[model samples]
Target chain A: MAGINEAKYMLGESVRMLKSGKVSNLISVIIMGFSLLVLVIYILVTLNVSIIIEKGMEEMCVYVYLEDGVNNSITEDIREKLLEIESVRRVVFVSKDKALEKFREQLGKNSDILEELGANPLPDAFRIQMKPESNASVAMEKIAQAATGWKGVDDVRYGKKWVEKGEKLVKGFYMTGLALGLIVFLSVIFVISNTVRLSILSRRESVEIMKLVGATNMYIQVPFIIEGAIQGIVSSLLAMALLWGVCSFAGRYLPGLGFFRFEGVIGFIILCAFLGSIGSFVAIRKFLKR
Target chain B: MLVYEIMPGEKRIIAGVYHLSKVLGRHFALQDINFQLANGEFVFLVGPSGAGKSTLLRMMYMDDIPDSGQVIMGAHVSTMMKRRNIPRLRRRIGIVFQDFRLIEDRNVFENVALAMKVAGIGITEIKHEMTNILTRVGLYHKRYEFPGALSGGEQQRVAIARAVANKPAVLLADEPTGNLDPMVTRGILELLFKINSGGTAVLMATHDVELVKSFGQRIIYLQDGKIVKDKEMLFRGNLRESISNSRVDHRAKKFTEHSIGEDYDGKRGR
Candidate 1:
């Protein structure tokens, strides 16, 4: 009966200390907020850059031209085969006459040259629009095989160098972003832990007095933990607000800047909140044990 | 009849520390000391500075562990006890310090209530008991006042109230009246006596030889970290002679009244 009452009283005292503003709750909140802010900015920038690379790849498609007198059935088969590959989105056929008309339109005064030629020498072509993540080199190789030994196919034209460079840039951004995020996360943890440690050091006398009064270690520790959690929550909110402001500002003015999808940005905000809380908890736990 | 009675001369051996030696880092704080305490006994421990009185008291409360020897409290041996068991032991033995280690953040009532709280007493009961104890210490009117605002004597009284709030079986006070005036000293001593008479054993360490000569029921004198004398008195006839021809000489006379200004400076320097 006595023990239970005593435990309840200790818990009440801990609550009182927390509410009285005696335990450096404000300092913790501020530290946590600042840390979350830095972390969120790092995350958002990394996310946006990755979006830009991926979107650029999707915009650039490859075009392949066929030789004169190429069999109609063979050309149709090649288009169908290109479509079978998962990377290929769709393929459209361009006839020889249509190609010649397009060339004439490109050169307004070139109609006389075309009439002088007296015959359509231009070749038909197929335009291949692939998925965003498609490997262009692999698609080209497959296309070359499909068109091999076919009569009248002149050549296959695709931007192999451009696709390779784009893919490399995307991968580089992803790796760099991942590495930067890890560094920022660790820095936040270090900062928060040290902040909590300083607070504990300043109030060691109070802790000693509590211990002498028969307060259990847990009773002594609860306020610090609460302070940490509160700091985490408040800091996370601040970080989220800052991120939202920057994103909105960019969205308004930087119209053509490819960035994180709106859905991904929202997901990142939620993730930041979770991380803030968890980081605070871990920081408090580490400091209190000491 | 008293509400609780400790049989006369029955001598309840509530706790004993045997041949305890404690080495903290490179310092030998307490060395091969032995002491025993019984229920309802009032004993004074007199020694000069650095005589290890506080260290001995800390061992009794299980705050510090002894490197060797056994500390037996009630039915349990302390050195073998787990950390979780130490609080239960502390609940039965209340300790008061000369500095009056009250939580500066809490008011007088909350300070007293903290002892009961750590012991797990219910809130309703904590309120009632803290009120009663503060009233007994004559500080009920100042219950809501913070410790920093109270005078030295009043702060010491609050410390006393906190120590006895849970009705501990034994009370250990390290110079409870060390910094108070004569009138306040007598009042604090009387409060301690009242508690002792109510069945809690009181062990107080003091440098006040005059006060000891006047009111000591039993004396345990320490010199150079050893018990030089242990005696009991049914009357003050022999005590007066013992005080007059004491072996220890005091170079400083009249026990200079260190003002509150000097008190803080002295403690801070230490």
Candidate 2:
């Protein structure tokens, strides 16, 4: 019962402080909201970029262009051999006529130029798709090596250079983002904690009087901690709301990113509450040294 | 009802200091001072401005811990005390400052009630106790007024009222009348005396030499972080000489009487 009463008084006191310091609290919320908004955008954009780049890498293929002297039996033998490789998911055999037909369909009205040549010069090719389990660069290398000296193969080609460079760029971006995220996380905590420290310092008289009167450390700390949590909660909601507004506005011009995921929204609120508790702890850490 | 009660035949020491020393940033604030205050005793801790009177009183209430000694109050002694036990120890003791230390935002009643509120006393109990203490301090009518609305004397009365609201076993006041004028000081002193009469051992540190000289109470004089005097006084003020001598100023006699007692009564000290 005594604990309940103390909690009630501390909460009331915290709310009173918040209400009295409106301008300062509002400014802090705005700054935190803006910072979090930037973080949200960075996270979502990186997530989408990573997904797109990874899908493109997964679809990478190695093409084995055939030598002109290759017969049907040789081409068939090469296709069967390519499929025997452990990393190969499937081997697609395209005859010269089939390749010409695909080119004609893609060129549309330019098919007349292709027909002017009378006979097709395009080579039969074997397209190799690697298992999803294999890394694009590794699978491409293995398949290129196995097919390079094959009886029907003239030239071995794959998009390994472009895909490898894309993978490196993505890995670098993720590493930099992780490092920057840590700095931003700590920076936000420091900024909020210092703000709370100044607020507590301004009320030094109250703290001294409370201590002199025999109020427990818990009694003194409860109000400040609750105040910090509330600030965190408020800023979180405000930042999310602002992000939602921006996302909705942008969604009209672009598609699919119009709303934040439910998990992201909930995670952000929890983060705010956690940060608030931490900020409060940092602010009042000095006074409770005894 | 939760007041720290002195059992009928318990030991009499309410607070004690033994070889207590305090150092602050390279300077010794108090050095090897020892004193014991018994139940219902009122002692005037007198010294010059830098004489460690405030430091001694602060140690009495555990606001300032000693550097190299023990401050024994009940079973909670310095250095042996746990962090969680400090507040419990404080609840049994009360302290008043030179500045009233009233919460400027809270009203007179709320300021006094805060003592009980912080203790987690029930609302009905707090209301009854606040009403009684405020009435005794003669500030019941100004209950709704903030500390800013009151004069220095009234503010000190609120400080006293708050300090004693919980019926603590000991009250350590550090110059409760330091900011008030002479007339206001008399009233505040009278009020303190009234509270002292109720069995709350009062230890007040003051630099008012005339007030100390005029009154006859236990005096613990301090100087240079040491106790120059710790003996009690049976009585002081020459009431008989003022009544017989024609050269004695009438205003001085009246001031003397008001400063001490109206009937010039004697208070024995041990």
Candidate 3:
């Protein structure tokens, strides 16, 4: 019963302290809001950029060339086998004559070179569209195994270097983004904790007097914790509002920048709320113990 | 109602300090002290500068725990009590420092009300009790005024009011009259006397021997962290003689409005 009353009294005092219109409270709230806003923007930009990179990677296609003198049945059998692999999304079989036609279309006035060749010298090829999520190394390995030792198969061709580099770049971006996000979050906590400590120091006299009058330690600590919590929640709300405004404005004016999505916005808002409350608790707890 | 009473015997000791010693770094604040105060007794602790008078008072209030020896209050030993029990022990004893130590942010009523609030009293009861105490301290009109706005005497009265608001069984006042005028000092001491008369034990530390000589029921003298003398005067002998001889002088002294600083220095120098 005493603990409950002390909690309520501390809460009341905390609210009273905040309501006193001290300059420290104003400064703390502003700093917290700004820090959290920066964090949210960083997360949103990183998430969108990652999505764009993934979409771009999905557009890359691989072409497998078949050798001359290969039987039609053998070519059809290879095509069937390629389609059996789960990574193969779609396979387009381009005949040698059709390949020559495509080459002529690309060359435009170079049709004479194709005619002089006199027999569709270009071999038939299977244009493979693998699933976007397929493991690059695994997909390439499966393709090589399928085409190796097959009749009339000349080579399996793909930009293996580009695929490997792209995957590495994507992973690097994720790690760097995570590290940066954590740094920003910790910096926010640091700033909030200092602000809270200053506020607590200024009210040290009141705390001493309270203690002298038989107030328990919990009674003295509660109000500061409540003040910190209020700062966290208010700052987070401000940050979310700012983020929503920016996202909405960008969506309206920047037509080419179609990267921003709303599916994760709710999750981001919840994250901000959690960060705000937890930051407050950490800051107040640290200040009170000191 | 039948009131069963026991036979008269030795006075019940409310607080006892045995060979109490407190050291702060290389310096000894209090050393080799032994004392006890009985229930419902008013005593004066007199000493010169650096005599550990305030330290002794602080130990009684459990503000600074002694480095050695035992401090027993009522049925509980101070050293054996847990940190959680300190507040409960403190609630039974009220302390009024020379600095007043009033919460400046709170008004007179709120300042006095805080004692009951910390004790977990209901708000309505606190309101009634606070009003009564504030009026008794003669600051009922300034209940809404902040401590900074009050005069030194009024502030001291508010401190006293706060100390008594919880009806503490023991009151330890460390130079309660240090910052007030002699007239105000008399009034404050009179208030303390009234509190003592109502069955609350008060142990006031001051260098004002004249004040103690005038009204102190019992006097304990200290010099260099050790008790020099302990005297019990039932307002007889020289106490009575001094009162009769200084009656006119006392009236003049009460009306003269001498500075407490001068009085404190004069008394301590003697």
Best by DockQ: 2
Rank by TM-score (best first): 2, 1, 3
State the lDDT of candidate 3 residue by residue for B78-117, as single tens digits.
6766565556656556889899999888899888887777
What are the clashing pairs of model 3? A67-A152
Query: Whose lDDT is greatest here?
Result: 2
True contacts kept of each: 0.60, 0.54, 0.44
Error at A278, model 3, angstroms: 5.7
- Candidate 2 structure lDDT: 0.76
lDDT of 2 by residue, A15-112 (tens): 87778778877887777777767777767667766666666766778989999868888888988888888888888888889999999999998789
**TM per prediction:** 0.81, 0.83, 0.79
Chain A only: list TM-scores of all candidates. Answer: 0.73, 0.79, 0.73
Candidate 2 chain A lDDT trough over 10 residues, lowest sum: A1-10
Computed on C-alphas against the true complex, the DockQ of each candidate is 0.41, 0.47, 0.40
lDDT winner between 1 and 2, please give it: 2
* Model 1: how far residue B137 lies from native, Å: 0.5
Give the TM-score of candidate 2 (chain A): 0.79
Candidate 2 runs further than 4 Å off: A65-112, A118-133, A149-155, A248-260, B1-11, B231-270
lDDT by residue (tens digit), candidate 3, A1-21: 455555556667777788774
- Give the C-alpha miss distance for residue B216 in model 1, angstroms: 2.3
What lDDT score goes with residue B222 in model 3?
87
Q: How do the candidates rank by DockQ, highest first?
A: 2, 1, 3
